[model samples]
Target: MATTLFFLLFFTPFLYSAAAPNHNAPQDLVRSSCINASYPSLCLRTLSSYSGPTGTPRDLAQAAVKVGLARARKASTYLKTSVTGKSERERAALSDCVEQMAESVDELSKTLSELKHLRGETFEFQMSNARTWVSAALTYEDTCVDGFEGVDRKVKGDVKKKITNVAMVTSNALYMIRRLDESGGLNR
Candidate 1:
């Protein structure tokens, strides 16, 4: 009886610990959610930094927008003041790109603030607006890229890389927000 008791006690924790490692639990939520995204890898990589066991789809979406905002802001700043040695047309295009990127940053900021005002039935409506704004931000970034065309190839390449990264992350944020609607993030 004592030996049996010893075995039970010794194996109980081991059994429990063995059962605790659920591979599906850690990333299943994020992976499944990101599966619908255009850039699933980028979505996962950008958002997994904010992942937690208890994080809901809403939280993930918010974190994505925050990351997008930071990237857009940094890109805007770089375009505004850093690049040099440009022709007249190149300088004009660079200036316009910086302005549009700043606008994109503003749109993302509005999205986060507006999320706090959503109601249950209207949650999708609010989310739609947010998604539209995000889309617009991407459009703005596209316009910025377009402006860079026919300019200095080197300068355009650098600025394009930065803006494009911001656009990709914003795209991920929009998809995450869409996932929120499916996950019942609208209601209290």
Candidate 2:
């Protein structure tokens, strides 16, 4: 009986350790982190595909950055190829707006690279760089919308909607990155 007890005590921990980490942990982390975002629903939607039950926060944050980068790029491409406005003045504004969106894509790409390069020793610095890039990307998205200020309502509305989607995702990525930074989840 004593031998059996010893074996139980010694092997129990090893058995437990061999099991997988809780699958729900990552989903909970995602929900808790997104609670503090400017647009919680948008954050959740943007990350829903990546924030799985077995997800790691660092992975989640990185995925958000990558997805946001792709979205920014797509929006920029659409703007560049689409014809806008009925007049020369409107066309000029639309062209400038496309350039802004292109810059926004660049910023998002930088944010993704910053997130991917995160190191425990340089976590703060990396996060700061990501935050700055995301902020600038959001600003560029906003500026694109603003460029349509004097255009016709239909044109402005259509352009604003498209740019706003990218901006919201960028904002969500920033919030997720902030969670990774402040929560010290990068090293996990």
Candidate 3:
């Protein structure tokens, strides 16, 4: 009984350690998947936050879009609050950025919806739409930054920094969507 207890205590940790990497296999997949993203580190950071299934390209694509949507929403709230205590021009720019972020959120929502319902018969068509919407979301993010031009330097810098972060995440989402498309649209 003493020998069995010693074996159980000594070997249990080794058994758990051996299985630990398999538990982290999903995170490793996320890391490798992010390697090709425009913002690889951000992609890894954002998608790694998802505790859902990440065993397939579709799963990763959905996670990316969801992360982008959440960021866009948060940015919109920040922009709205930032409109106060700004010059008139800065206020205008912030207002435009708010609208652009709203559009971005809408596009990302549509992309997420499409990703969730990707059927084999219409797989190509759905993927094309998803890519188009994600690309449009990225464009809207870029336009938000463009609106900040000619505003106060500090305001422009602050707004640009926030918008750029959102844009990078959205761009990463687009990359994931394209990767999903190239992965044969859910067949893998």
Note the Cα lDDT for every prediction shown. 0.82, 0.78, 0.89
Model 1 C-alpha lDDT per residue in residues 89-183, reported as the tens digit of each score = 87899889988998898899999876656687778788888888988999999999999778778888988898889989999988888778676
- Model 3 per-residue lDDT tens digits across residues 1-188: 99999999999999988777576767877998999999998998888888778767888889888888988999899999998888898899999999999999999999999999889999999999998998899899999999877888888898888888889998999998999998885755
Best by TM-score: 3
Candidate 3 residue spans exceeding 4 A from truth: 1-21
The true-versus-predicted C-alpha distance at residue 89 of model 2, in Å, is: 1.9
lDDT of 2 by residue, 1-188 (tens): 99999999999999997795876677686677678877888776667666333266677777777767888788877776666436776787779888898888888888877776778898888888988988998988888888887787987787788888888878888887887887787665
Looking at candidate 3, what is the lDDT of residue 15?
93
Candidate 1's TM-score reads 0.85
True lDDT of residue 132, candidate 2: 90
Please rank every candidate by lDDT, starting with the best.
3, 1, 2
RMSD of 2: 5.0
Q: What value does the lDDT take at residue 117 in candidate 3?
A: 89
TM-score of each: 0.85, 0.81, 0.86
- Return the TM-score for candidate 2, rounded to 2 decimals: 0.81
